[model samples]
Every structure is written in C-alpha cells, then in structure tokens.
Target chain A: MVNLTLIIALPLLMAFTMPIFKMLNSKLPKFIALLTTAFNLIVLSSNFTEIMAAPLILELGGWQAPFAINLYVGPLALVAAFLINGSAFILSIYNLSQDYQFDDKFYLLFLMITAGASGMVMTGDLFNLFVFIEITSIAAYSLTTFAGGSSYEASFKYLIIGGVGSVFLLLGIGFTYSAVGSLNLAEIAASAGLINPLLLQITALLFLIGIGIEAELFPLNFWVPDIYTEAPTAVSGIMSGAVSAAGIYALARIFFTLFPAQQFFNYLLVIGVITLIMGELIAYQQENIKRMLAYSSLAQMGLIVTVISLGTEAAVKAGLFQLINHSILKVLLFISAGVLISAAGSKKIKDLAGLGTKKPTAAFGFTIAAMGILGVPFLNGFISKFMIISSSLNADQFLITFLILAAALIEIAYYLKVVQKLYFEDLEIEVKNTAVITVPVILLTLLIIGLGVYPQLIAEPLEKAAAEILNNSRYIMTVLGGI
Target chain B: MLNFLEEWSFFGGSILLIFIGLYGVLSRKNMIKILISLGLMDTGVNLLLVALGYVEAANAPIINSVNPSNAAAFVDPIPQALVLTSIVIGTAVLALGLALVMKIYDKYSTLNISEIRGLKW
Candidate 1:
C-alpha cells in the first residue's frame, strides 16, 4: 500500500531542498542527502511487494497515457531503486568522515544524479528517458570533477565523451518518435515495425552509442578511468554503483520496450562479446587500483551486455541478477580501494604490497569483494556469475558462454593478482596509517557476504522481474490501453 | 532554403558528420581539438534529430488552423521540443568541458593528451 508517487517525488523534491541546506550549514546538505536516500530506500523496499503486484502507473499532470510523462513501477524498477539507494547510503556514510569542501553543491548534484537515474528506471516514455539522460549527464559531469583541479580535467574529458553519447541517444529518440509519431516507449515498441525499417535501424545504432558511453563499453570508455581515478571516492562509489547502473537500466528498458528487433538484438550480442574480450584484456594490464577497478567495471558491464543480448527470459533474469550484484560488489570494491589508497600512500598495486597484514579488516573487505567478483564459491559474485553462465547455456548460446567464461577467467586473473599483492608481498617502503574500519565499513562487508551466501535474496525478485519484462503482452496492453 | 534543409540527404549527411566527429576524437591528440571534434559530432546528431521531423512545406505546429484535420499536415513540433532540450544539454556539457580543460591546463600546463599520463599504469 505504499504510494509509489511519494517514493519517486522524494528524490526530486530533495534536489530543490539540497541547495537550500547549504545556506543553512555546509554539512546540512550531505546529512539531508543521506537521510533522504535512506528514507527512499526504506519506503521502496517496504512497498516492494505492493508495487510489484499491481505495477503502479502514474501519469504526470493528469495527461492520458501515450501523451503524458508516465511513471511505471514494477519489480524491475524497484530493484534498481534498492541498489541505488542502498549503495548511496553507504557512500554517504563514507563521505561523512572525509573533510571536503563544496559539500552543499556536491550533495545537491548527488541528489540530482540519484533522482535522474531513478526517473530513467521508472519512466514509461521515450522522450522522458532522454530528458532523464540529460539531467543525469549534467549531474555526472559536475560530480566527476567535484574533487577539484584534476577532477575538473577528468570531468572535462568525460563531458565531451558523454556529450557525444547524449546526442546519439537524442537522435535515436527523435527518430523513433518521428517514425512512430509517439514518445511513449510501449507504444513505440508495438508500432516501430510499422515505420520505415532503415530509419529504425539507424536510430537503434544511435541509441546504442548514446547509452554505451554511460554503460562504459569499449572505445567510449576512455573517460571512465580518468573520471573514476580523479573524482572524489564518495562520488566514484555512486558513479560505479548507482549512476552507471542507470545506463544499463535505461539500455534494457529501451531495448525491450521501444525496439525489440531480432536483428538489433543480434548486434547487441556481437558488440557485447567484443566489449567482454576487450574490457578484460585491458583490465589485466592496469597497475593503478582505481584504473584497474575501472577496467573491471567495463568487463562487468560487458558480461551484463552479453547476458542481456541472449534475450531469453532466463538470459534476462541472469543479466538482471548479475547487474545488481555487480553494482553492489563494485561499490564495495571501489570504496575499499579508496580507503586503501588513502591509507597506503600510493595508488599503484605494487605499492599496496604487504599492507593487508597491517590492516586486516579493510583488506578483508577488499578480499571478499575481489573474490566475489572473481566468482569464487560462496561469494555473491559467484552466484550471479553462475546464473548468467547457466542462463546463456540454457538458451544454447554456447559460444557466448565460452567467451563469458574466458572473460571470467581473466577477471579472476586480475582480481587474484590484486589479492596476492594485498596478502603476499610487502611494500618496500615503511608502513603508514590505514583508513579506520568503522560501522558502515563493517556493515557493507557483512552485506556483501550475506548476499553472496544467500543469493536467493536477490534471485527470487529477479525471477519476478524477468518474467514481468518478458511479459510483452501485458506491457503493451498497459501502454496501448487494452487490446 | 527551408525546403533545401528539409531533404532526406540532410539526415544522411548528418550521419556523416557523426562519423567525421568520431574520426576526430579517435585520431586527434590535443585535448581541446578532441573536444571540438566531440562538438562536431553532437552538432551532427542534433541536426539529424531536427531533420527527422522535417515534413516539407509544413509550418510551426499550432492549433491556429480553422479545421482540425488540417492540423495533421503541419510540421511535427515534437522534434523541435526535443532539439531545444538537446541543445541546452549540449551547451552545459561544452561549458563543463572547457572548465575542465582550464583546470587541466593549470595542473599540467599542456593540452596534449599523450603527455598527460600521471595516472597511467
């Protein structure tokens, strides 16, 4: 019985209030942000079942379905909400301990990023998705450089790259609208084929490049490492975990709802495989911890793409599960890396040698996250990786499964290399200070392990979500207003 | 002039602009130049969006027409709305890019991306 509108509106309203909190006090904004995200997470998770059962649809401004902005809520969108707010909550806790300036504007931008992403996941219109993408990009560009000097530089590069991506997306959305004469996604999905095929094909390509930028696919991923490395670790946590997940979520929504074409799905398959091979191959060469994680993020996205391209109910299910797990675990890994970098006095993996013995708990969190990502048994990463592989196999996409597994091996290769460096080797230099292991750090560590062990915690809802996404008939009926 | 801009080639040509911009980004070394190249690509894409809704001889969409059915023949205004939003976003990103370039210049004193390898493995 939770009101879905309130959940969606909470973040948007916070965007406005975030700025004013700065006038009151510097820390007020972040404190407000943490409180808001925590509240939204509780509200969304508590009503998770009610919304999933009925899948509440709200039309903005009382405009009728096809013509107005619509908010569509289902288990799929709710899962995205949970992952975003949950990680955002943890990252805010980490931020509370750091002494950074511009706290007000930073948190304001952060709230907008969260709101924009949430809007993308919940919106039912093609045009609205583009609008959300714009807001998300602006917020992301600001936050990417919010760490200051070099951060500004990285944000600049990211802005250019992101700008290109947005244009591609806008062109795609425009073309889709022109062809079908409708901005509603479900309507576009139903009627896209009736439009000129060539135009639709081109639009699909545009959309791919557009979304691909945020998704951190190959070639377009140049901005990712720089942004991740230079930006404040708190913001990077959201970027890798929440902001970035929004990209994959939007990609899934558009592909399923606006242009569910066989030919394009096949293209997705090839492109995804390429990203998988390239992302992993390059990640192995990285020496810097943040850049290494950046490459790993690409590799993870490639796996999500691969699973999604399989385009079966099982494949979609596995992909969704992996997507959530990747977001959560990646955040944990990035934050742990941030803590290590700050404590260890060096960014290079070789510099981090032997420190784990000195700081067991922080390193332990890193160990759990790294092992989970490598699909080591009993870790959350292992469960999702197993599901994606099995789902692809069940769909009889053997070659893709082989490639994904090969990528996983590379994943293990790099993850273990870091693990070895953390445990076995000692830094040639004298040991320094370490980031304090606080309650939030302990909580994140425990959650990663808990979810890793009981993956059914996520899998059950993902099953419902997968079924709902593949339920094209029901989706079309809702948007098209009955047969 | 309006009729000329309304041709199907406009869309095709815009695609070429995107490819050219991509080439610039991939091949260019100067950070500022690469940014310009990105701008070129964005322009091309935005033009394509505007071109998508071009119906020759149509006017700006409004309900001023005496008859209801006649309004269907007017230019599609949806693309115009989309373009406005896209243009605004593009501007924000470009400003952000320039600001970053200024900051990077202050730190590194050079615009050459190749020399900017402080974070490299």
Candidate 2:
C-alpha cells in the first residue's frame, strides 16, 4: 500500500497541477480535483483500521523516527480524515453546475484547502502543522472573498483576528520547541511532563487562545456569525463542517498529546459552558437562516468541547459521535438551507415563508435535520446525546446532565422557529423553483438520515478512535520509541 | 554608554510594544489601525523568538572549519529557523489583511469599526 503521507500531500500536488492543467483547458481542473480527492478518500478509508489499531507512522522521504517530519495516524486522525474527505467529495459534487463556475484556479485552491486540512489531521509535528494551517487559512481567506463585496469585508475581519491568532500560535510553537528541542508531537508528549513548567504554561495558554478562534470558541468567536452569513453556502459548509472540526481537533490533539494538563480541561469546561449558553441564546435572536445555523454550530461545538474535556471513554466517544453526527447534520441543514433560500429569493428566515409548500422534499430534509439536532428518539443525535447523558450521569455529573438536556431544548426552540416559518407562515410569492435535488446534496441528506438511524456505523469507529486517544503512550512509543 | 543603553532599551521597548498592540486591538476605532497594531504584535512575537535564541558572543549556526561538537556555543539555530518561517507567514497575512481592509474601506467608506457595526449582534 502507498504510504498515508499521500493522503495529506495529494491536494498540495493538485494545487500545483491545477494551474498546469489549465494550459490545456479549464475543464480538466474539476475532474482532476475529483480524482485526487476520490483517491484520497478511498485510500484513507481502506487503511482506516490499520491506522486506528497500530499507531501507524509514515515518515516523509524515508527518514525515520523523531528526526523526520512524520504523518501519525491513530484513530482520531482516521475519523477526522473520514469526515473531511467524505464531505469534501459530496460538497464538490453539490457545488458543481451551481451558479458559480468552478474555474481551474478555484478547483485548484479547493483541492489545496482539502489537502491542507487533511495534512493538519495527519501530521505529528508542530512546525509542519503551522505550515498546513497557513495553507488552509490562505485558501479559506481567498475562497470566501471570491464572491467579492461584503464577502471581502467579512473575510478581512476574519483575516485580522485570524492573523492575531496565528501570531499567538506561532509564538506557542516557538516556546514549545525551545523547551522540548524537537518538533515531533509524540516526542513532545513524551517530554511534556518534564518541560519547564513556566514555558509549558505559556505555550499552552497561547495555543489555547490561538486555536480557540479557529474552533469558534467563545470570547474569540465574534467573527463566526459574520463570516458564516457572508460566505457562499458551500464555503459555509466547509467552514462549519470540516474546518471547525480541524481546529477543535488541533486543540484536542495538542491538549492530549503535546501538553496534557488537568488545568486545560478546567479552562475548556468553563469556556464551553459559556459558549453553549451564549451561542444558543444568540441563535434564538438571529433573523438570517445561515447566521442561526452558525450559532447552532457554535453551541454544538460547545457541547462537544464539554464532553471531550471530561476525558472519559464514554464521554470522549459521545463527543466524537456527536462531532460526526453534527458535521453530517450540518451539511444537510446548510445545503438545504441554501436551496430553500435560493428558491425563496432571500436569505432572511421570514422571507422563506411557505417554502415548505414550494420545495417539499428539501423542506422534509431540513425537518429531519432539525429533528436530528434536537436529539429526538431513533435519530443519531439522540444516541450521542443519550451516551453523553448516561456517561455524565454515571460519572455523577448531575449538573452537566441537567444543562445538556436544557441545551437540547434550546436547540429544539431555534430550529423549530425556522420549521414553523417554512411550514406555517404565508408565502406571498410562489417560488417557481423546481424540486430538483442535486445528486451530491441528496447523497449528503441520505447519509445524515442513515447515520442517525444507525449510529453504530460511526460510533464503533469513534469508540476505537476514543480508545486510541486515551492510550497516549501508544502514540508516544510509536513515534519516539519507548522513551 | 549611550550606545549600550540604546541596545538594552529594546528589551523593555519590545514588551511595551506588545502591550500597545493589545491595547489598540482592544480599544481602537479604525480597523486599519487595529490591523497595523496586529502586525506590531507579530513583530513582538518574532522579536521574542529572536531574543530567546540569541547567544552572547557566538557565531552563526553554519560551520565548516570549526569543530562540530563545539557548536553548542553558537546561537540556537532552530528557533531562528522557526521564526524565519513565522516572519514570512506574517508578511503574507499582513498583505492579505491590508487587501481586506481596502475592500472594507471601499464598501463602507469609513475605516472606523463602530461605523461598520452593521453585522453586529
């Protein structure tokens, strides 16, 4: 089998290749991108078990161990890769033949964004992670602004705040490197307990702040609603679904691997609770459909963070299961929201009145998504939430269980607002939009429904993933060799 | 004496500069000025990287005639290498941010963030 390094590097290769292919004709770019991503998705999925079980490390250029920049794939990496590549494939198909033209350059940047994201999920080195993050950041910045006008304004705001975050991240990387004398994540984890406490403390705080913005955590997440509402829907899908997961994964990885700390979890718990309360409360106030989903996404991530910080088998697995479900449900919600908005000719929630009558199938997909998010029975969100509540309850966290169930109600309220507008409100203008469910969006909707019905399809793999994360020494031993 | 004082002054000045950047981002009206202050904060980070890696009476990391084992006395090269990458990435971000500021300016006509509070909650 080809090394897993190819999984992270293919998009970079295609980024360069797309420009060259443009010399022949612009038509070649989209297929080439599809081919590269398809190949990556297949490769990543096929090796899913090997990476999950064995602490697989793929060294770049045949260099060995901590000396080489390595791609370390454990269960977390595999699950992230699965979500990223799988969703990218679906989103690409959905975006194709939409109003926007997929020029050679656009496809090239798109593939590069995918590659950079996958690389972040796979790599085990701090320096390389920074490089890949920049690749993704630049691609995201330019991609969002491709619509021009206010998109540029929103993108600028993202860039300024994002730049500040980047500086903090780089500063953290420098401090950590100076302390550990190596860039390898496994090595850092091995040496973490012994590093200078002051330096490690500084580095950890810096990274927490830096990556928090990208993850859309509170106190630094002021940019999300604006950026989400402003970006094109496909970009919005990628931002909320794939990129947010990447940022959270980075935060989780560094906290778990680079610097394991009880204090960090304490911080995560407090911040996550605040974000959950604020996000749902704010989502309740939004008029725009996309903006509301953005707030909902923030709240869901807040819940994930809360459970992830618990650092238990059940809690971690519940978090992962929810993460997977959230991504699937979100894309379904976002794409259908886009379709509904397009049909109704305005993005304002009130303007979409009677859209249910106009596009019944799309309306039905959105309804299922709403139900899934609300943790209704038999759906995937319910299983994950049940796991979270059961695990928390078992752990004697009665307060957590109470808040989680309360948050579920808030989720229901906000989602029902949109549902009511679509089904109950009057449609002054009959949207002539046909019930044309595009192939990729349809597939994505089905995946959401399917996963909700049978969460074991994802939870089993996530459990394996969660087990790997807790077994930190396996990662430490694999890359640094019994240190 | 004055030259030595000037040299040592950069130490406190760098810290002050970072504080200033923070203050600007926290309190400024003009978005562009806030972005400039962000660049200054990056300067502080880069400076910190450089200062930590500096060795008092040392040569550069490159060596040919010198004994290899004695290289410990030289400035730590890794942080410098790391910071060089940071500086380039910072420049790229600055350029991108400036482009965005120009766009924001073109649309809103006013650079004051308070004036462009149209998207706020």
Candidate 3:
C-alpha cells in the first residue's frame, strides 16, 4: 500500500526545496517542480486500484481516530486529488516553455497550491482542512500577483474576498467544535444529530458560504473574472482547473458527510440554478476572452452543483462526471486562451480574429474544447450533460431540467459566438507562434474526444466515487472505525 | 443580565468584531484601513476560538507526572493549537495583502478601490 501521506507531502517537499535548487541553478526550479508533480501524478494513478477497493485512512503521528489528524483516501477524494495533480502536472509542462523573471517563486507557489489542494481533499480533520485551505489561498493570492501590474489589484480583491471567506470558515469550525467537542469530520458527523438544530443550521450556512467562495458559486465569485483576466494565463488555468475542483470536492464532502439534510440539498438546488443562469448570462456579455471563459467556467460549476444537489446516486455520479469534464475542458480552454492571447497580444474577442487560421493547431484545439463544453456530440461534455439532464428528468425535476437546458442554450450562444469569431473572422493583425502550448492543448483535446467516444473508460471509477460520496455511513466508519 | 453578558461576552465580542471588519471592508475607502480591518476580524476569530475552549479556572493543558490525574482540570488544547496556526496564517495573509496594496498604490497612484478600475464586469 502506498503511503497516502506522500501524495500531499511530496509536493510540499518539492515546493520548499525549490529555493535551494534555484540557488544551485537558475533554471533548476521549474524542472524540479515539473518532475515533482509528474511523480505525484504517477503515484496517485498507481494507487487507483487500491483506493477503489477500500478507502485508505492514514492517521498522523501514529495516533488513532478522532484523536489524530487523518487523510482519507476514498474514491471521491482520489478523483479530486487526481484532477489536482494531473492539471498541475500539465500546467507545469506548459510553464517550462515560458520565460518568467521569478520562475523560482512561481514554481514554489505553484507546487504549494498543488500540495494544499491535495491536502484539502484528503484531510479528515476540520482544523487541518482549514490549514490546507489557508495554504492554498495564500499560494493563490501570491500567484495572482506574480505577473504584477493589474494582478496586484486582482490579488487584493481575491485576498479581501478569500480572507473574509476564511473567517467564516474558521467561525464555522469554532462553532462545530463547540457543539460536537470534536474536530474530526467523522466524529462530528456521527454526533451531529445531538447538536442544537439551529446551531447546526447556522454552522451549515457558514460552511456553505465559506467554501462557496472558493467553489466559484454565483454571488461569491466576483473576484474570479478579474483574477482570471489579470493573473498569468497559466495561473488562471490551474486556478480554474485544479483549485476550483478541490473547492467543489470540499463543498461536496462537507455537505454530504457532515450535514446531509434534504433542506440543504434544496438550497443547493436553488443556488446552483441561480449560479448557472447568472454565470451564463454574464458570460454572454463578456468582451474579453478570458473573462468570457471564466464566466463560462462558473456556469459549468453551477451545473455540477445543481446535479450534485439532486442527491440521487445517478445525479451525484453525473455531477462527478461533469466535474471531471469541466476540469479537463477548462484546462483546455484557459490554456488555449493563454496561447491565443499571447499570439494576438490582446484579449479582446475582435483583436483575436482570424488567428484560428493563423494558428490552426491552437484553433483546432480550442474548437474541440469549445464544442466539448457546448455539449457537442462525440465529445466528453455531451455525455455528462446528457446524463445530468436525463437524471434530473428521471427524478421528476422538470423545472430544473428546463432551467438547465435554458442555461445550456445561453452557454451555446456565447461559446458559438467565440467559435465563429475564431474561424470565420478576417485577420486584423499578425499572430505569434503558439508552438510551446500546442502540445498540452492537443493532448487535452484528444482526451475530451476519447472520453466522449467511450465514457465507459471512466464510468466505473466515477460510479464508485459517487457511491463513496453518498455512503455517509461508510465514510464515518472509515474514519471512526465503528465508533 | 450580568451573567448573560459574562457568559456570552467573548462570543458576542467576536461576532461584533467580525461585523465591524465586514463594515470596514465594505465602507472604508482606504486600502490600508481595509487590511487593518481584516486583521481585526482575524484577531476576533482567534479570540473566539480560544474563548470557546476556556473553562472556568482551568489550568494550562500541560500534562506531566505531577498533573497526570488532573487532565480533566486542564482546558481543551485543540482550539489553542488551531488558533496558533490560524494566527500565523492570518499574519501571512495580512502581509501579502499589504504588499499587494503597496503594489496597487505604485501602479495606480491611488489607494481608493473604486478608482483602481483596471478590471470590471
């Protein structure tokens, strides 16, 4: 059995040692960071069968159960960790081709984000989860400003918003500890029924709003666009792909395991629908490509949240599938946007006209991603979207079904507009070479199509992940070991 | 009334500080003041966490042979550990925020958030 702790620890070790490597060789840090993430990806993938068989519980310091911090390696957590490390690895490869003045610091923060994200999904202790969240946010905040200029403003906005979110999370944690006299998620969950109903509700709300900020839910995601637009493109890719996936995982973990209530799922349904509509509508009006993509990503997150809120086994399975699809699609979109923006030297839709013909590889990759996100047939996104809609219908949620379709129509409208501009619009300016980023873009595109063609490749794992999420008793048992 | 105030004072004060911080973040125009307010909120949260673990005349949770039988007499130590970590993280965030504000001032030549409109809806 692979030590589950290494998944979180390896990246942290690599991140902290990056400075020393930088001192040895100026170009060494990026290479080390890349190798570290690649190693972690391999390690994570190798343990798939083991994790799928049974959840691996790693208690820290050799202590037992609620007395010690533990890392829970269930299928749900494994899927999230895979997404985080997988995207980080790809982004690291993309980073290798780019030139930055502070490459060392960039890699340091990058690796820290990966480690923190991995830790966030795996840790079973509430305070430990908070610590990991802080680690991730701190790294993210610094990374937002890595490009300087307007990024400082973007980072500051993220700080203010994320800082406030952390406060809410801490307050919620305090309240939970006070009520349950325990910090372990399983123990708290087991004893949750004994807590005051009103206090429980308040704590649930506090956690929802707190984690909602990171998950990019509507009303809490105002900082998303600015950060995505202003931060470096690679940072945007990781933020949207890896960080947001972890956020959603954290949200799902909390709701499903800690506070599984019918009313809360109803609230999630309402919030998800609103977020979907709001993100899609606003995404339609965005002139800048990054902002458009950011808003669209938000809309996709809304869809996942909505489906997960359904609380049906098939719905949760579909939601996890969509979450995976969104992460892959966002990585492709943001990285392609990064390449396109760099090629055109502008982020405006009109400014990037006809680069599709100029840079056929990137344009092709972006088209595949756009189609996948638009739920085009023979793409991964189509399958997940179909599953979610069908499951909603099966559950007799006709209103939700209609709203989701309406939101998809809005999604189609905006993404199609960008597609038209990419291929049909006349060239207004010369485009730069996109040779460096084309590899990852093409790889992700192929993955999208391959998955779409045969989603059975991931169906078993996603089903297990969904079951892991819905099986609250199993989770409690894994952590508390029959109390 | 006195008993209620004494019992709930710490919790109430933390909530009050959090609200004040939120107000400052929303109402204050200056960037530095906003950061300071964020610091206030962090401090308040830390205080509340420590207060939650407080027991009426409890000793510090250092258990040695002399105090082996007095484990129950000591206060809960988990919240204190959490607060320690939280305080460090809060400081890091505060420093990062202040650094960003410094850079914002350099780029825009203004501290007013409303004026730093490089990005918007």
Candidate 4:
C-alpha cells in the first residue's frame, strides 16, 4: 500500500528545494535528482503488481471519483511511468559526469520535467493533464537554453509552437468540460456518448492538434530537429526518451479512451505515416549527427502513433513495445553521441570518423543502438519491428506495412553510414578527453540484448498495458467504482 | 437575441483574439510582438474558459449569506478554477519566452526572428 503520488511529489518537492540544497552545498542538486528518480522507480515498482492486477485509483482530498482529481495507474500508465522515471534515472547518472554552468538549475529543471511527465501519465483528470503538460513544457523550454548558443533561438521557436499547442489543448478541455460538465477523464468517458456529434468532432480535432505538436507528429514538428540538435545531450536524451513518451501516452489516452472515433484514428494513421516517411527522408540528409538522430526519433514516434491508431489490442501492444525499445535505444544513442561529439570536437559526422579505437565504449554504444534501431536480429528493436510488421499485416494494412519497411530501409542506410564511418574510416581530428560513460552504456546494452533474447520478459506487462488501453470502459468502470 | 449575443460574443471574441495572435505569430518578424500575440492568445483562451462556466443571472461561487442555499444559481466553478491555474501558467510561459527573447537579442543584436538564422529547417 505504497502511496503512488510520491513518484510525482518527491521529484517535484526535490526539484523546487534544489536551490536551497545548492545554497547548502553546490554539489547537492545532481545527487538529489539522481536520488529522486531512483526513489520514483522504487515507488512505481512497489505498486506495479497491484496496479497490474487492478488499476489503482487514488481519489485526492478525501473526495470520490467524478468529484475530485484522481490518479489512475493502469498497466499502460505504469509502464509509461517506468519508462519516464527509468530514463530520468539513467540520465541523472549520465549527468553526474558532466558539469554545466548553473548545474543546480539544470538538475532542478531536469527533476521537474521528470515529475511533470510522471504526473501527465498518472492523472485521471483532463485539467490535471493540461497542468502537467504545461509544467513539462515550461521545464523543457528552460532546459533547452542550457546549450547557450543557438539554443536560445531553438527554445524560442519551441516556445511559440508549444504555446499555440497549449491554447488548442485548453480550448479542447473547455469544450469537453462545457459538454460533459466534468473534468475527470473517467466521468467524461462514461458520458462522452451523449455529447453532440459535431462538438465531439471539434473537441477531438482540437486535442489532436494540441497533443500532436507535443507528440512530434507530421506537419507540426518543425521545432524537433532544432531543439534536439541544439540542446545538450542529456537534455536531448530526456526530451526524446521521456517527454515524448509521455506526449504519446497523452495522445493515446485522449484518442482511444476519451473519444474512440474511427475518423480520429484515420487522421492519426495518415499523420503517423507521413511523419514516419518524412522524418526518415529528412534524417537521411542531415550531416549533423544529433539532428539525424532527432529526425530518426521523430520517425519512431510516428511509427508508434500509426501502430497504436490501428485500434487493436495487438497493434497497441506492438506500438507500446516499440515505444519501450525507442526510449532505451534513443537514450543510449544520445548519450554516446554526446561523448562522440565532444571527443571529435565537432557535431559533423565526418569529424567523428574512425574514433572507434580511441572511444571504443562510445562507438560501441552508438553502433549497437543504431543496429538495434535498424532491426538487426537479437536486439530489442528487432523484436518490436517484427511485432509491428506482423500486427500491421494481420490488420491487412499493406500500404502502411510497405511504408514502414521503406522507412526502415532508409533508416538502415543512414545508420550504417554512421557505423561504417565509426569503425572503418580514418580519424579526421584529434580526440578530446571525453567522459567515460561505461556504466550507463553497459547497463543499457544489457537491457537491449536481454530483452531481444527473451522478449517474454516484458510480454506480460506489454499485453496488459495494451489491453488496458484498448478497454477504456474498464478504465471508466474502475475509476467510477472507486466512488 | 440578447442572450444569444451574450453567449456568442464571448466565443467569437476569444476565437477572434486567438486568430489575431496566430496571425501575428506567423506574420510578424519582431519577436516581442510575437510574444505579445502569444499573451493575447493565452488571454483569449482563458476568457473562453471562464465564459464556459457562465450562467445567466448566476451569482459568484462563494456561499455568502445573501445567496446561500441556491447552489445551482452559481456559475460552474471548475472552469473558473481552471482558468485561474491557466492564467498563472500563461504568465510563466510568457515570462520565460521574454527571457529567451532577451538572450536572443543579446546574442544576435536583433529582435527580428528572420534575421536570427542560426537555426533553420
């Protein structure tokens, strides 16, 4: 009977109190962030079995569901929270080796972003979701500026886009509240059938646009390359690995649970496909390693969105699996890429040529992550990619299947280009003293290989999560029955 | 007709404000103006949220002796509460955006976003 709220509260409490800790000792914030993320993981794991058995609904302020803001941690949310906190935990370790100007503020924002995302995944109220989204976006907006050169420009662009997106989100929430007379998601889902059809469509469209921006879908993701390219490596890693996961979770919850309309799913399907193809095509052209990885991550988000939008249990399961894989692989890629970029003294792929011998740990980390993403066998990405294809084929989506494979081909082309350069090409520049990230790289590699070898290790959780997402009525019933 | 005007005016005005802000964001090159427009959009959304809870001839949500026992007479309070929270968040974002704009100005020596071509697709 561990209180689940502490997963969010502890990080936020620690984040806000970070400056005080810094005043006490300048070195305390990083350890505080590390401790908070670790504690969050422990809290989440303690509640995992119970939540999987039955979605844990915690009503706040002694009020019942439909009357108060509650937190519903179903298997889907639990898995997403795990990914968010797990990425944060790993990145906090990554942070220990790196120093930044105003390191205290950095960890503070980092911890807040982690807390905000965890809140986004766990909350059962729409307004609470909006608040969490704002918190995460604000922290992200500040976090991006840490790189200090063109990062200001990137942060501004992201701010404008994110600001507009939040307006739409608020409008959507307003519409939903006006129609349903309740902000609690479970209550709204229970009564959503009664909303006027046209209004429902409008609300759904508003939410799609709003959440779509955060999820980095097609036509609304121009800010992705810049922010990911300009932000510091750990910031970029968390943005890709944790924040975007939460964004997709919110989108899925909105579309699948709140408004299960086929038309919306069709829209998501089309958007996802376009995002996938466009991202890979653009990623293929980037000489900057971080920007290429950024586009590739964008494409992965699109792939996950398309699969989940298929609105089948198997499709959702495959999507979630791919999501898990993407988070793990992308964090490793960013971390190693961070190391490689520093060692090569440039962001250009050419400058990083033949550093494999000098920076073997980083190069190996990057190569394995890339190979995993390219769907080489006996890697985590291979399992997810196989599952995605099989599920899409079972659903008889030939065009989608074809497009996905085509994207994978482009992915392989660019990734192999990097790998070939890493091991085969001559060194173009003298290597700098790069931080040794042996521990995080080894840990992530083990997870990737271990998952690939025995996919069943996470099969139960993935299946249950997919089931939880697909069955929104059960969500409504569970939350409402808690009253 | 008056009732319709009252209702549609709030929705129409807010939507119009949002469109104006969006146009400013897309059309203006000056960064400060764009942030102002963003503020306007946020204000518009907040207004719309508050309007959503409006009830004709309704009292405030407070339970004073004058209007006590008329629970239904008060406008829906949730949207107002939400708007309060949103207003605070909007201000924070605006403040953050302004700070970023200041830093950008310091770096590029210009406020025009088009001139600051450090990043492009």
Go through the candidates in order and give each one's C-alpha lDDT.
Answer: 0.79, 0.80, 0.88, 0.92
TM-score of 4: 0.98
Model 3 lDDT tens row, A1-483: 467788778878877888898899999998988898888888888889998899888889899967789888899999899899889888988888987788888998999999999999999989898888888888999998877767887888889989999999999999999998999999998998899989999999999888998899878998998889888878999999999999999999999998898998999889988989999999999999999998988888888999999999999999999999988988888888888888998899888788888877777878888899889999999999999999999999999999999999988898888889988888778777653776787678778999999999988789899998998988998888855
Which candidate tops DockQ?
4
Per-residue alpha-carbon lDDT of candidate 1 for residues A232-286, written as tens digits (9 for 90 to 100): 7877888889877888887877777666777888887887788788888988999
Runs in model 4 deviating more than 4 A are B119-121
Name the runs in model 2 displaced over 4 angstroms: A430-436, B1-13, B64-72, B118-121
- The DockQ of each candidate is 0.56, 0.60, 0.75, 0.82
Candidate 2, residues B15-100, lDDT tens digits: the string is 67777887787678787788889888888878877766776768788765773666457888877887888888888988888887
Candidate 3's DockQ is 0.75
TM-score of 2: 0.94
- The runs of at least 3 residues in candidate 3 whose Cα sits more than 4 Å from the true structure, single-residue gaps closed, are B1-5, B63-72, B118-121
Per-model fnat list:
0.79, 0.67, 0.85, 0.92
Better of 2 and 4 by lDDT: 4
Tens digit of per-residue lDDT, candidate 2, span A292-344: 99999999889898888887889888888888888888887887897898788
The order by descending TM-score is 4, 3, 2, 1
Worst 10 residues of 4 chain A by lDDT: A427-436
The candidate 1 chain A region of ten consecutive residues with least summed lDDT is A430-439
Better of 1 and 2 by TM-score: 2
Q: Which pairs clash (backbone N, Cα, C closer than 3 Å) in model 2?
A: A380-A452
